[model samples]
Target: MTDATLSRADPIHYQDATTLAALIRKKEVSSREVVQAHLDRIAAVNPKINAVVTLMAEDALRAADAADKAVAQGAVLGPLHGVPFSIKDALDTAGVPTQRGSKLFAGRIPTADATAVARFKAAGGIALMKSNLPEFSAWTETDNLVTGRTNNPWNLDRTPGGSSGGESAAIAAGMSPIGIGSDVAISVRGPAAFTGIAALKATQGRVPFTGHYPAVTKRWWHVGAMARSVGDVALGYSILKGPDGIDGYAVHPREADAGADHIPGRLRIGWVAEAAFGPVDPEIAAAVASAAARLADLGHDVEPVDLPFLGNPLGALMTLVFGEIVPTIKALAAGREGDLHAIGAGIVATPDPTFAAYLEAEAQGEALRSAFAGFFERYDVLLTPVNPMTATPHGAQELVVDGKTVPWTHVMAATSPFNLTGLPALSVPYAFSSEHLPIGIQLVGKWLDEATLLRLGAMLDRKGGLDERRPAL
Candidate 1:
């Protein structure tokens, strides 16, 4: 759906949040119509993808009625006045079940919303439902004891990359316009790349993490926005940004660039074809190199630059995540350890984290952060592949790359570095494989500099927003 025709009937199913809001404000469509369109889309597509697990139909419809009334009364509206949105199950939503894809919290509900969700509600967005994620949001596949597994809309035989896999699939399937997602390693970017959409991992603390499940484990985790366009990402970011006062890291308020729509300068972009973390598929590498060439065509300075400390980010990430997470699992599990997911159970089963080991990982992480910050001194942005290859088959830990098997952790290599460094990164769709799966290039910017990433992302998005073809559900 193009921006020019957003008010049309059938294609409103694929429009972005900003356009939907405009349609609502102009009375081209009522909020109830917009919300019901998405709910109907969910009913049609969700069974195949299993992305949206729990439906808040009655509550969402009630909210949509209120939004429509506000529009009719000419009440001042927030940017997202009446658009439909989804929340990841990992985030707390008031009166909404946040099962976290595990039996341990099967009927869990939060009395208060996560800061992100609260802000979305305040913006006049309708919360339609909760999307699926990995149990405790721990691994890279959206399967647990609860919602089963979420498959890629592009190919049901393949997995939709997780831990925000369900959100990506739901968005790709046109079930929701924008949703909240968290990333510790590659959760947001990997799934966005695999599903052919947009997702942001802003600098550490750029978006508050308060009220998110696994609330505070490892400093690398972040909560950010996912949508069909970079403009929508910026819109969501504008509404969700700033310190919630509770998360020590989210210390700043909204920025001037939150309203800025264009790239300010010809950015000097650093491009890395491959890093030390893993081998890349020839197709994926070619796609990223093409993106760099495209930027050069646009008259930007695009050149290759070596990155610092790309070795074994999975090792560093796991070291820090388990070190921080194991203690919490032990405390929460008590005698019900068996109820936890295998990944969670294993963390509890491991020997207690040593202070010396945690200290060592912290030191390494700090150095990595400094290295990325220093690299940004030479270039305004860095570009790399969001993943080495396309989505893998369900339950397959090893990917058959170039006729050789590689560990599943390779999917996260390019993206995990930004998590450690706290630099902002965004996944933008670029190309497709011979088999018709999606490929994406990532743009990394300086700390708290999400504006530049969104700007470049908008440029890339204009070429193709969702895809040349939508998923045939």
Candidate 2:
């Protein structure tokens, strides 16, 4: 890499994928140059956070050269032509190792690219690296026997938020501008929020789950696009949203809502900061409430409302996800228990969840879904903090927030409900904690209404509060 490219002063390292693609298309920056710049970035930073586990350096460079030739020859190019993107390790990449954070599958390779990955490549985005995740993509921190641990770039001692932690860390650190992450509970949005970036988990089935592991999470599972801007995320989602005909979860086609952000009048924004997600940090709560106030000041009607069904949204989600996943994963790990991650092994060894418990959880989930649907009837969107606190320490058992020791998944309180209800939710970076950590707010919209969530997210994006901050590392 050239000295110019290696310098942190090179703004290309921090530019969004859309901007990078535009730059390449305009011939101001060659595709090879863009890819190499990111390679240099990863080489310099990956050692610190271990965000990217597998680097496709040679293939990415070759692809970038072909992209440049296509551009030079005046060939029609896709929207993301020549842009570099990171893939979460759980997703399959043909000819690439996709260990999914387990030693049992250490040398495993895929015969085909995951649907989302193929769609990204078809759109001219190069998959430059595979980001790490917890074993089986099941935890709140990114660490496993395969890739060690992925630390938060902001503070090396803190976590980057998980399952999608490595993806978010890479994006936040500018190793890659956009990536894909799966969220069954709080994986994608929580990590995005924790890392101070933009991310959206569209309604269940909006994106396919065909090429990823832990297929059992399919009931409420979704693979979402994580990017630096709401539009970039919307753009990623636009390309990957249609049914791939493989993942049964991907049934409905998203409607064209290109104009979702062009609001003709003030929006009705309902917000809840305390009751549903208990005892949130004052700073976190203040950040979200302030965002609501900002929108209200901009002519929208922002009010505090209580949705009773959210009383135990996380509890309901846990019951449903664990109930369904325990059996499926247990069966998959039948003979390979010793090689699995500790959490995975423990899950498999645990007693099977009862059918009655599954039924009851499903019933509670339906009621919550119906209640959220009614809540949306009275509001255009709902707003709240993405987590009760900022990122926690690696392997943290609990969090001391507001003078109380809370479970690490307190971050899921605001995000998991949307996963359970299959409603669209977007996480936008709005503020920084006193320690200079990122704090994000969640914008929840009606079912399959990612367009509206993006609309609200765009409004927040314009503020660019988090853009001014970057990891010191």
Candidate 3:
């Protein structure tokens, strides 16, 4: 749907948040109508995909009415104005059940919104629902004792990917135009790849992790925007970023380029396929090549570049993440062990983390970050596959890449390095697999250089025509 004909009845829920906000500002469509359309879409599709675990139908509608009233009264309006967005259950929503896809927090509700959620609300975006996730948003597929499982919108027999799986599924299926998702390693980018959407894990601390469940393990954690289009992700990021005063780690060393919308004339683009991560699916590798060729076609200097620590950082990343996460899980599950799912139970059962190991992992992480800092000194953007493969079958424990089986955990190979370095990474769909599953390419940028990443993402998105195709749900 083009902006020229946004007023037409063409399923307003499928429109990007930017367009919806513009339509609301122009009064071409009432906020109630827009919110109602998404609510209706959720009702119709949520049952099949199981993405939205909590529905805010009445509250969203009420918020929409207030937004419409603001428009009528000519009150100063925020950029979002009347758009509705989904939230990953990992984030808090006041008076709304967050649950974290765990039985322990099944009915838990926070009195205050997460910093990211508050920013969205302040920007005029209404909270539509809390999307599903694996227990404690830990696993790579969305399923838990409380919320069951979330299926891919394109194929119900497959997973939508996690821990941001539900948000990706909801946006890809048009249930919500945009939403927030957290990434420790691959939560945002991996799921966005699995579900064929656009997401950005901005430089760590760009978006505060305050108010998110299991918050202690945040050294490598990041909250980011997920949408079906790069523009919407960019819009959401603009509002979601900056320090909220409550999260000490969050800071705005420098603002993203005001001219991020305009890509600088030509860029030094570097892409890596299997070299960065071993054994990528043939089709996914081709997608990376296609995107590189397209970038070259766009008059940018494109080449294949490799970093020594690319595929080797996952061990250290996991070490640091699990070192903190295991204790947090054990503390959170003290009296609730019986309620824990298999994954959570297993996590809690792991041997106690060692301080020596923790320090070693931290050192490894610092070295990885140094490597990336050095690499970025010569390149503006680094491209790679978001995952070695596309969306896998539900509850998949292994994946076949290049006709060889590898543990599904290999899925993080292409993504974990960025988290270790706290560099900004963007996941944007570039093509579809032979079976028609969506394929996404990752774009990594220098620290606090999300502007360059998003700018290049816009060009790739435009040339790739991501909006030209949608999941045939």
Q: By lDDT, who's the top model here?
A: 3
lDDT of 2 by residue, 262-304 (tens): 4565778899887668779988888888898888887888999
Per-residue lDDT for 358-423 in model 3, tens only? 898888888888888788777788999999988899878878889888997899989988888888
Stretches of candidate 1 off by over 4 Å are 1-4, 7-10, 256-263, 275-277, 462-466
| Model 3 stretches with alpha carbons more than 4 Å out | 1-4, 7-10, 253-263, 465-467
Whichever of 2 and 3 has more lDDT, that candidate is 3
Candidate 1 vs candidate 3, lDDT winner? 3
Using all chains and alpha carbons, the TM-scores for the candidates as numbered come to 0.95, 0.95, 0.96
Of candidate 2, the 10-residue stretch with the lowest lDDT total is 1-10
lDDT of 2 at 31: 87
- lDDT, candidate 3, residue 352? 67
TM-score of 3: 0.96
In candidate 2, which residue pairs get closer than 3 Å at backbone N, Cα or C atoms, i.e. clash? none
